[model samples]
Structure formats: C-alpha cells, structure tokens
Target chain A: SQELEQSPQSLIVQEGKNLTINCTSSKTLYGLYWYKQKYGEGLIFLMMLQKGGEEKSHEKITAKLDEKKQQSSLHITASQPSHAGIYLCGADPYGQNFVFGPGTRLSVLP
Target chain B: DTAVSQTPKYLVTQMGNDKSIKCEQNLGHDTMYWYKQDSKKFLKIMFSYNNKELIINETVPNRFSPKSPDKAHLNLHINSLELGDSAVYFCASSLGPSNQPQHFGDGTRLSIL
Candidate 1:
C-alpha cells in the first residue's frame, strides 16, 4: 500500500511571509505533482517533478522532489491573500495513478 | 472552455438511492480518472480508464462503478448510496495514464441523507 503524509496540516501566515509545505511518501515516487485548490473548488495543477533533486517554480510557488527519501516540498515565496488555499502533493509510485496527501490548508492573513 | 467538466455540481439523495455523475473532457485526452475526497481532504483514486479500457481500480467498493463511453467521457455510478458516501467526487483527464499532468473538473459534491 502507498501512503502520503503532509506536514503542518494547516498553516496561517501573514501577507508577504513565506511558508513551505512538505509531502513524504512511503514509496519511491516515479512522479510528483503539486496542486492548489480553494475551499470547495477544483484543484489547479501547479507543477510536476520527476527526477531526484528536480525543482519547478510557478509565479510565487516552488516545488522540489527528493526521490532518495521519497519526499517533496512546496514553497510559497512572499505569500499573498490569493495564495491562500489547500496545497496538495500527489505521488505516482507506479507511474499510473496518483495518491494524494491529506493536503495542507493555508490561510494568508492580510 | 472547460477542459474537464462534471455535471451536477452538487447532489443530495437519500441512502439506498442510486446516482450517477457524468464527466467529459474536451482536451482530447486519452485517459480519464475518478477520485474521491473524504471529509479530511484526502484524495484517493477510485478508477482510471485509458482509451475506454479500465486501467486502475484502487480496491474501490463494488457499489462504485466507473464506465467509459469513450476516450473523452467517464461516468461514475454509485449504488445504494450510504451516509459514509458523502464526499466530493472529482473527475479528471490527462493525455496518458502516467507522467502526465491532469486537468480536473470543479468536482461534484455528494451528500447522502
């Protein structure tokens, strides 16, 4: 069975501050994806990482994959109110279907 | 245009009733998937179909059936809906079953009473 665990189940940050969310998988990740979703809304894909030590950034968010430890991290730089949402990390252990983590809820206080 | 869309954004029904959620993708993707988001926001893959063929069914309950009419459409039918079935169901599609970024629909919220 594959499992994904996320750190800091929920986070609160002031505007302009930075925060990082982590996703650790029980199995090696063939691919890792990062997505964001507003409450009750559909998820929007942010980035995808496949190789170990790979990193990708979009706008204000950055994601990295550490294949050795089966870990991935999503970092937001200079957070804003618009960045407040649920950050989810998904891992593809078998290169087929994704198993998403429990998600990290982020709240940006202005 | 919505790349992936699911009909009936919200559904409310009594237990023991049957319901279905329809999904379509205009992106011409060859793969479609069904995912369930539980109350704690844990997203789990229920099914994945590629080119109208079932690719993955993650040990989901028999009551949950996924049908693919074509490469662009996948529908989920739930039988004997139970209160525990209340959750958000998301429909998504990708160019392939693996190593592809998926497009997601707004999701269908199912509530069983």
Candidate 2:
C-alpha cells in the first residue's frame, strides 16, 4: 500500500507572503493531484502532474513534481484570504486507487 | 450548473439507523467514486464504479453499500450506522478510473448520534 506524507501539518502566513507545502509519497507516483477545500465545502482541483520533473502553474499557484516522482511541492505567491483552506495532495501509485495525505491547513491572515 | 452534486448537504441520524446519500454528475464522466473524510481531514476511497460497474472496493465494511444505476449517478447506503460512521462523504467523477483529475461534489456531512 502507498502512503503520502505532507509537511507542515498546518501553516499561518500573512497575505501577500509566499508559502510552500510539500507532499512526499512512500512509492513512486504515477500521477499527483493538488486540491483545495474551503472550510465546509468540497474540494476544488488545482493542478495535476504526471511526468517526473513536471511543473505546472495556474495564476499565482505553482506545482512541481520532483525528478524522482516521489515528492511534490505546491507554492503560492501573494497569498490571499481566499487561498486559506485545507490543501490536500493525492497520489496514484497503481492507477487503481488514490491515496491522500493528511491535509495541510492553510490560514492566510489579512 | 453544478458538475457534481449530492443531496442533503447535511444529515443527522441516530445510531443503528439506515440512511442513503444520493450523488449525480453531469460531466458526462464514465467513472464515479465515493470518498469519506474523517475528522482529521483524511480522505479515503470507499467505492468506485466505472461505467456503472464496480471497479474498486476498498476495505470498507459490508454495512456500506454503493449502487450505480447509471454512469452519472452513484448512491451510498449505510446500514446500522455507528458513531464512527459520522463523517463528510463526498462524491466525485472523472473521465475514467485513472489518470484523470476528479471533480468532487459539495459533500454530505453525516452525523450519527
């Protein structure tokens, strides 16, 4: 079975500051997904990285998959209150199911 | 329009009772999944159906059953629920079982008293 570990179980940062959250998997990942969930809402897909060394960005958020495909990081620039939520990383190891990490709670204070 | 939707955003019921949660997706996806988020915010896959066929059934107990009458709808029924069964259940859908990013519903918050 594959398991995922996320660094900085929770974080508090000032708005307009930059922060990064890391996700590491016990096994090589076939696909890595980044999602953000508001306090009581569903998850909103952010981005997906498939190949090793792949990096993608949307607006002010960027996600990168390491060359080893065992670790991924999500970086947010100029964070806003809207970015405050639970950030979760999910990994697909066997393409059969997804294993999610214990989410990193982000609090951006204005 | 909502891509994925679940009925009864919140559910509160007594233990030992049976309850059903309904999900529907209009994304024209072939695969649908049910996930449970615990108090720790750890999301776990409970069941997955591809094209109305059961594809993945995790270590979930037999008391939890998932039914997919069509590719766009998946319903979950829990029998004799316990206190530990209380959690936020989310429904998701994708183009296929793997490689595609899943779209999640607003989730149903189930509370067992």
Candidate 3:
C-alpha cells in the first residue's frame, strides 16, 4: 500500500506572501495531482504531474514533481484570500487507485 | 453546465437508517469514483467504476454499495449507517481507469445521528 505525507498540516500566511506545501509518498508515484477545496465545497483540480521532474503552473500557482517521483511541491506566489482553503495532494502509485495526503489547510490573512 | 454534479448537498439521518447519494458527470468520462473525506480531511477511495464495471473496491465494508448504471452515473447506497459514517462523500470521474486527472462534484455531507 502507498501512503502520502504532507508537511505543515496547517499554515497561516499573510496575503501577498509566498508559501510552499510539500507532499512525500512512500513509493514512487506514477501520477501526482494537486487540488484545492474551499470549506464545504468540492475539490478543484489544480494540476497533474506524471513524469518525473515535471513542472506545471497556472496563474500564481506552480507544482513540481521531483526527479525521484517520490516527492512533490506546490508553491503559490502572491497569495490572496481566495487561496485560503484546504490543499490536497493525491498520488497514484500502482495505477489502480489513488491515495491522498491528510491535506494542508492554508489560511491567508489579509 | 457543471462538469460533475451530486444530488442532496447535505444529508442528516439517524443511525441504522439507509441513504443514497447520486452522482452524474457530463464530461464524457469512462471512469467514476466515490471518495470519503473524514473529519481529519483524509480522503479515501471507496469505490471506482470504469465503463459501468467495478474496477476498484477498497477495504470498504459491504454495507456500502456503489452502482453505476452507465459510464456517466455512479450512485452509492449505505445500509445501516453508523455514527462513524458521518463525513463528506465526493464523486469524481476521469477519462479512463488509470493515470488520468479527475473532475469532482461538490460532495454530499452526510451526518448520522
């Protein structure tokens, strides 16, 4: 079985500041997904990384998968209140099912 | 139009009661999945169906059953729910069974009293 561990279970950052959340997997990941979920709402897919050393960016957010494929990081630049939510990392290690981390709660104070 | 949608945004019932959640996706996907998010915000896969066929069934109890009438719809029915069943259930779909990014629904919050 594969498990994912996310660092900084919860974070509080000032608006316009940059922050990074890390996700580490117990096994090499075949695919890594980043999603954002507002309180009481469904998750919004942010980005997906498949190949090792792959990096993708959308607006102010960027995600990178390490060359080892065992760790990934999501970095947000000039964050806003809208970025405050639960950021979750999910990985498919066996190609059969997806395993998710405990999630990182981001609170961006204005 | 919403890519993925779920009915009854919230459900509250007594223990031992049975309930169902319906999910529909309009993205023309071939795979659908059901996930439960516990209070700790840990999301776990409960069931997955690809093209109306069961593909993955995690260690979920038999009391929870997932039905996919077609590739676009997946419904979950829980029997004799217990207090531990209180959580947010989300429905998601992808283009295939493996290595594809998934689109998710708003999720149904279930509360068992």
Candidate 4:
C-alpha cells in the first residue's frame, strides 16, 4: 500500500499569515492532488500536479510537487478566515487509486 | 447546480439492517470511487469504477458492495451492517483513475446503532 504522511495535523494562524502544509509519500507518486473541505462538507479539488517539480496555484493557494516525486506542499498566502478548513493531500501512486492524507485542520483567525 | 450528488445525506439504522447510498455525477467523468472516513478522520478508498467497469477494490469487507450502472452513477450497498460500519461515505469522480483530479459529493453520514 502507498502511504502518505501529512505534517502539522492542525494549525492556527492569523488571517494575514502565510502557511504551508507538507505531504510525504512512502512510494513514488503518479500524481498529487490538493483538496479543501469546509467543516461538514465534501472535498473540493484545489490542484493537481502530475510531473516532477510541477507547481500550480489557484488564487491564494499554491501547490508544488518536488523533484523526488514523493513529496508535495500546499502554500496559502495572506490567508483568510474563509480559508479555515481541513486540507487534505491525496496521492495516486499509479494514478489508479487515490489515498488521502490524515488531513490538516487549519484555523485562520480574524 | 450540484455537479456530483449523493442521496440520503444522513442515515441512522440498527445493526444487522441493510442500506444503500446512491451517487450521481454530471461532470462527464469516466471514473468514480467510494471512500470511507472513519471516526479518527482517516479517509480510505473502498472502491473504484471506470466507465461502468470495476477497476479498483480495496480490502473492504465483502458486506460492502459498490454497483455502477453507468458512468454517471455508483451506489454502495452494505448488507448486515454492523456498528463498525458507521462513517461518512463519500463519492467522487474523475476523468481518469491515474492522473486526473476528482470532484466530490458532500458525503453521506451513516450511523449504525
């Protein structure tokens, strides 16, 4: 089984602060995806990185996949209260199945 | 409009009963999956179907079955549900199983009493 470890199980920060969450995989990733879930809601696709060293951003959220193909990061700039939610990183080792991270619960305070 | 939707948003039933959750996606995606988020908040893949064909099946108990009648629908049926079967079940869809990002349904919260 491909395994993924997410750091900082939970985070609290001021609204304007910048934050980053890390996802490390035990196996090479076929692709990496970032998702955000508001409390009690379903997961929302944020970004997808397929190639090594790929990077993509959506508004204030940027995601990067390292060259090693086993690590990825999600960075949020000038975070806002509306960004507060549980962020999950999912890795597809062979691009056949997806396994999600344990999820990083983030709190962006006003 | 909701792109992906699941019916029976919340379910509460006694053990040994049978239940089914329905899912539909209008995204024109070719692949769909079923996932379970346990009480500990760990999301695990249970099953995956591509174009109405069973593609991925995890080590889930045989009691849990996923049926997809077409590319747009995937339904989960749990027979003789047990107390341990309670969790938030999610349905998702993607263009491909290997590389595309998926769209998800809000989720169905199930509780087996």
Best by DockQ: 2
**Residue pair clashes in candidate 2:** none
lDDT of 1 at A65: 90
Candidate 3 residue-wise lDDT, B40-63, digit = tens: 888999999999999999999999
Q: Using TM-score as the measure, which candidate wins? A: 2
Model 1 regions more than 4 Å off = A67-69
Q: What is model 3's interface RMSD?
A: 0.7
lDDT of 3 by residue, A1-110 (tens): 88999988999999999999999999999999999999999999999999999999999999999999999999999999999999999987785578889999999999
The positional error of residue A14 in candidate 4, measured at the CA in angstroms, is 1.1
Give DockQ for candidates 1 onward, in order: 0.87, 0.93, 0.90, 0.89
Give the Cα error of residue B62 in candidate 2, in Å.
Answer: 0.6
Predicted model with the maximum lDDT: 2
lDDT of 1 by residue, B1-113 (tens): 88899999999999999999999999999999999999988888999999999999988889999999889899999999999999999999999888898889999999999
TM-score, chain B, model 2, is 0.99
lDDT score, candidate 4, position A45: 91
lDDT (Cα, tens digit) per residue for candidate 1, span A15-99: 9999999999988888888999999899999999999999988988889998594999999999999999999888777844578
Report every candidate's CA lDDT.
Answer: 0.92, 0.95, 0.95, 0.93
- In Å, residue B64's CA in model 1 sits off its true spot by 1.4
lDDT of 2 by residue, B1-94 (tens): 9999999899999999999999999999999999999998899999999999999999999999999998989999999999999999999999
Tens-place lDDT digits, model 4, residues B1-113: 89999989999999999999999999999999999999978999999999999999999999999999989999999999999999999999999877788899999999989
**Model 4, runs deviating above 4 Å:** none
DockQ for candidate 4, please give it. Answer: 0.89
